[model samples]
Every structure is written in structure tokens, then in C-alpha cells.
Target: MEYVLVLYIEQALKKGVVQTMEMGLAEMGRVLRQRVLLIVLVTLLAVGLAGAGSFLVLEPEYEATTTLLVQSKQTEKGIAYNDLLTDQKLVTTYGEIFQSRMIAEAVIERLGLDLTEQELLENVRVRSSSESLLTAVTVTDHDPKQAVTIANAMAAVFMENLGRIMQVDNVSILDTAKLTSDVLEPVRPKPYLNMAVALVLGAMAGAGLALLLAFLNNTVQTEAEAEQLLQLPALGAIPFFEQKGSSGYRVVVRQDPRSAVAEAFRTLRTNIQYDEAGKHVKVLIVTSTLAGEGKSMVLANLAVTMAQAGKRVLLIDGDLRKPTLHHVFHLGGQIGLTEVLCEGVAPEEVILPSAAGPDVIPAGAIPANPSELLGSPKLRGLLSDLRIRYDLVLIDSPPLLPVTDGQVLSTLCDGVLFVVRSGEVARDQLQQAKGLLERVGAQVIGAVLNGKQRKRSEPAYSYYAAPEGDPHD
Candidate 1:
């Protein structure tokens, strides 16, 4: 039993290792797939740079080769196997002697070449074929004529010295050193091969860098990230929309009702209506961690969408410090929220109708103390009164981190819809924003991930398609 249990444990360990390896491979594939464009662009640039450097930076070297046949001197008896074996052995020895300092010095003196023995030997190479008694000596130099001259002189000097040094005089020249007209093109520094290697290296470097950046980036980028970081459900993910020609203050849902941007708001409307605490969430305040997060834009568009669905929606600009509803709605911001709060103006007087959709009440004027005004008792009473008249009251408040206006308004509202700009708010900042709302006893119903751009490779959603009736896969 003990032996069987140990065997089982070994199997389990092997299975676990395999699973871990599979997981690692999957992760690598994901990283490479997502950053393929960056890798390709970097690889192309590297290949161009390497090819250009090979041509412009590296020194050119020309080569000249001399082949020789090694044999025994003519004998009365026919050449024997032993003689062939001995000649083959001497071929290797002669190869070494071809590059020796003695032969290099002789060749330099005989050819009047201006080079030291070491430098001359460094430029020369000799190789002996294993299957034959053939030795080839090659010389490389910047000048093609000099390389040929050195190679031929080295071979001649080796033949002359062989008889004196080893008493063997059977060396025969098979081919003299020669070069073609195209000797200017060097054999080393192959540009095409260098570029190919550079491309692969650059691709690897780019992919590694992309993976590192993705791992280090701690910003909220997707709906999943927003929900995971903030501990709240993702209410909606709004796609980024580019403003085209003839740009004016108009809600995208009203101007281009068939656009994806308009569909996103409508989806947001359905989500809000079906949320766990949504039935009682009539007064919803829209705010984000910081300014320029598109919370105000989302609020305005959502208000327009809800109104188009025949709901009585009241769009109020609660950001008194820096009001933009007037600009968005193309209405006068002279008399609105401020007039109603300080002067006790009638709600109907400040609440004006928009040509596109919804009734908008712009922040009248910039207040010196926005937090104080929002935290007043009358503001809460005003919201309560508006809730009774309108089916839904959507307030576009200031960002939570910059001011206390949104937090104070959160206390009065039924629910808060936190908006996060994808890739804009860091994880730590989003966490802090959520903590602040929770500390104030605010009911954060859900979060909206705004300005998310869809990748080009993703398939398009059929907005006009009919729903399928099938329930099973």
C-alpha cells in the first residue's frame, strides 16, 4: 500500500507540473497576441537599422584562396596505402605550417607586404579536408590584390621551406590564388543575414517590453478591472466616440440615434432600471474620481436616452464650481441652480426644455463655495421636491476627489453611479474614491467604465439584429 501510494503521488506531481507548464504557455501566448503590432513595428525598424549599419559601419574584407595537393615524391614502386596515409597526415601538419609565423614572415618579405608576423598570420587561415590529401590556404585583407598576393606568396614559401624543415618535398600547387572582378563585395558582414537576426532579436525585445508594461500598468482599463478594483458591479462600458464634421452641442443619441454610442446609453438605461437597488433609485448622482472622466457627458447622454424612452427625466447640473451643462445643452447658464438655491426661484423657472430631449437645469454661475451650497438643507429639500415631480432626476455633480460637492450630494441622492475613465484613473486613486464614498455612507449602486475603445480586430456587434429564440448551445 505504501509503494502504491508513493506511485500515485508521483503521478499527481507530474500532472501538476504539466498543468503549470500549460498555464505558463497560455499566459505567454496571450501577451504575444495582444502586443503583436508593437513587436512587428519594432522588428521592422531594427531590421532596417541593422541592414543600414552593415553597409555603412562595418569594414569590408576580401578573401583569396590557394589549394594545394600533398603527395610522396615519384617512387619506382606504385604508390602504396601507407604512402597515401602518410600524405594525408602530412596535409594536416602542412595546414598548421601555412599559418605559422615563419611562413607568414617569409611571405611578407617575399611580397614586400607591410605587416607584422602576428597581423599577417591573423588574416590567414588554412584548412585540410579529412577525406583527401588536399590543403587550402586563404588570406583576407582590405585590398583584394594584396589578399591574392599574400595567399600565393604564402603557398610558394611553404613549398620551399617544407624540404629544408622536414625533408619532404612532394607539395604540388593545384590552384593559384585568384579573384573575380566582383572582389569589392566583402564575404563578411552579410547585410541580409544580419538584418534577419536583428529582426528576430528586436521582436523578442519588443514583446518582452510590452508584457512588462502591461504587468506594471495599474490603471483601470476594462469593465472587469473597474468592478474588481472598486468592489462594485459594472453598470455600463461606454465606447469612445470621435466628433466628426459640423460639430455642435448635441446629444449623440439624438443626433445619431443608430450609432453605437447611442446604443451604449440605451444599454446603460436598461442596466440602471434592472439593478438590485435600481427600482428605488430615482435620484441618481453621476460622479467620478477626477474631472475629465466623462461623468458629466455620460449624465447628459443618459438623461437624453431615458427621456427618449418616454420617462420624465430632469437633467440638473450640480457641479456649481465649473458648470458645463450649458455648453453641452447650448443653453444660457445665467439663471439656473444658483438662482434656485440662493434666490429661492421657482423650480419651473430655472428648469428649461432642451430641443433634443430632457429638461436641463444648468449650473447658473460659478460659486465661491460649492461644497457649502451643496451641503445645505435646502438642496436636499430641492431634490426631494424634484423627485416627486419627475420620474427620474439625474444630477451631474463635481468629481469626488477634487471637491466635497459630489460626496455631499451623494447623501441626498437615492444612489450614486460612479464613473471611471478607462486608462485614466490609477488603481490606488479609484480605491480611495470608493473608500471615501463608503465612509460617507453613500449607496454606490454600480460603476460606469467610460471612454473604452474597441480594438480593430474585434468583431462588430449587430445593433439592428433580432434576438434569437434558442436557449441551448
Candidate 2:
């Protein structure tokens, strides 16, 4: 039983390793796809540099080779098989001798070349096959004729020294190095091979850089990440969209009621309406970790969607410092929340009707003290009064981390709906916002992931035409 348990544990560990590898590969593929342009640019730059170096920067080198045949002197027995094998073995030894300093110095001296023995040896190469009785000596230089001269000179000098060093004169020249008018091609600086290698290396470097950048990025990019970091349920994912030739705030649910963005708002509305804990939530505050995250736009559209669903909804621009609900609804912002709270103005007089099917209350005039006014007893009483007048009251508050207005408003609201823009707010900022709200004893119902990047391959939400009554009819 113990052995069986150990085997089970071993299988589990193997499965875990396989899963880890698969996840790593998936993350790498995602990074590669997102940074393909960077990789391509890097590869092209490397190829260009390689081409420039190969053609213009580096000097060309030419190679010339000379071959020598080693054999036993003819005797009564033409040549024994053993002697042939001995000669073949000697060919390898002769190859090393051909590249020795003595041969290099003699070749340099005979050619009147100004180079050290080591320098000349560096440019020389020798090769011999164990199965054959032939050795080849090759020399490389900048000039084709000079390479041919050095190679032939090295072979002759080696042949002259072979008799005295080994006391055998059986070596003969097989092929002398020669340069024809058409065969003066340089063997160095292979442009195609260099460029190919540079491209591969550059791609590898770019991919590594891309992975590092992805690792360092701390923004909440996906709905799942936002949920995990903020510890909130994702109510809806709003897809990003652009309207050509339009500006300012847009009420997608009111204007283009059939768009994916509009449907997303409807989904959010349904989730909030049927939420087990949020069903009775009357006053909900919508805010984010920072400004410019589209929280105001989300709240505006959400109010319109609720009104369209046969519910009485009141949209309040609680962000007095930077109110946008009036601009969104095209309503006059002369007298609204500020006037009602500070000026003792009647709420009925300042409450304006919007074409978007909701009662709108703009931010009115900018106040020197928004935090003080939001936390006043008058604001709390106004919200309590509005709670009885409307089925749902949605407030647009400022970002939590930037000011205490959202936090103060959250204390009065029944629930808070956090709006997070993808790739805009970092995970730590979300955590901070969550902590601030929790400290204020606020009820965070859920979160809306706004501006979510949608892939083209993912099927869009659209109504397909139903089949007409059977063709048999």
C-alpha cells in the first residue's frame, strides 16, 4: 500500500510539471503574438547590419589549396599492402609537418613576404584522410594570387624537408595550387549564412525582451486578473468600441441599442437586479481606482439601461470636482447636486429630464470643498429621499485613491460597483481601492471590466435570423 501511494504521488508530480510547462509555453506564445512587430523589426535590423558588415566592413579572404601524394619507392615487389597502409599512416604525420613553423618560415622567406612564422601559420591549414595516401595544404590571404603563391611554396618547402627529416623521397606533388581568371572567388564573408544567423539570434533576443516586458507589466489586463486581484465577482465584460466622427460621452445603450457594448450594459443590469445580495440595493456608487477609467460613462449607460427595463432610475453626477454626467446627457449643469446640497435649492427644481430615459442631476458648479459637501448630512438626506422616489439611484463618484469623496459616498450607498479598465489600472491600485472601500465598511457588490480587448476570432453577440416556417409549407 505504501508503494502504491508513492507511485500515485509520483504521477501527480509528473502531471504538475507537465501542466507548468504547458502554461509557460502558452504565456510565451501570447507574448510572441503581442510583440511580433518588435521581433520582426529587430530581425530586419540585424539582417541589415549583417549585410553591411559582410559587404562593406569586413575584408574578403581568398583560399588556395595544394595536394601531395605519399607512396613507397618501386622495388622488385611493386608495393606491399602493408607498405601502402604505412604510407597512408605517414600522410597524416606529413600534414602536421606541412603546417609546422619551419615550413611556414621557409615559404615566407622564399616568397619575400613580410610576416612572422606564426602569422603565416595562422593563415595555413592542412588536411589528410586516414584511408588515402594524400595530404592537402591550403593557405588563405587577402589577395587571390598571394594565397596561391603561399600554398605552392609551402608544399615545395615541405617536400624538400621531407627527405632530410624522414630520409624518404617517396612524396610527389599531386596537384599544385593555381588561380584561374574565373576561379578567384573569395571564400570568406559568406553574406547569406551570416544574415541567416543574425536573423535567428535577433529574433531570440527580441522574444526574450518581450517576455521580460510582459513580466514587468503589473496592469490588470483581463477580467480574471481583476477578479483575482480585487477579490470581486466580475459582473460583466464591456468590449471596447469606437464611434467615428463623434466626441464626448456616449450612451451606447440609448443610441445603438443592439451593439455589443449595449448588450454588455444590459447584462450588467441583469446581474445587479438578480444578484442575491444586491437585489435590494437601491443606491449604488460607481467608481474606480483612478480618473479617466470610463466610470462615469459606465454609470450613465447603466442608468439608461435600467430605465429602459421599465424601472425608474435616477442618475446623479456625484463627482462634483469633475462632473461629466451633464455633458454626457447634454443637460444644463447650472444648478444640480451642489445647489441642492449647499444652496438649499429644491431637488425637484434642479432635477432635469434627459432624452436617454432617466432623471439626470449634473454636478452644477465646481466647489472649493467637494469632500466636505459629499459627507454633509444634507447629501445623505437627499439620497434617502431619492431612494423612496426612484427604484434605483446610481451615483458617479470620483476615484477612491485620489480623494475621499468616493469613500465618503460609499458609506451612504447600499452597494458599490467598481469599474476597472483593462490595461489601465494596476493590480496594486485595485487592491488599494478595495482596501479603502472595505475600511469604510462599504458593500462592494461586483465589478465591471471595461474596455476589454476582444479578439477577431471570438464570435460576436448578434441576433441571427430565424428560419422561416418550413419550406414544405
The lDDT values for all models are 0.84, 0.86
Q: Which stretches of candidate 2 lie over 4 Å from their true place?
A: 1-62, 71-97, 100-102, 105-120, 129-133, 141-146, 161-170, 178-210, 243-247, 461-473
Off by over 4 Å in 1: 1-36, 54-61, 68-97, 100-102, 114-119, 128-134, 161-175, 178-186, 192-209, 243-247, 461-473
Best by TM-score: 2
Cα displacement (angstroms), candidate 2, residue 353, comes to: 1.5
The TM-scores, one per candidate, come to 0.79, 0.80
**Residue 266 lDDT (model 1):** 92
lDDT of 1 at 419: 91
Instruction: Write the residue-wise lDDT of candidate 2 on 237-263 in tens digits.
Output: 998865222766678887778778888
Q: For model 2, state the Cα shift of residue 400 in Å.
A: 1.7
Report the poorest 10 consecutive residues by lDDT, candidate 1: 14-23
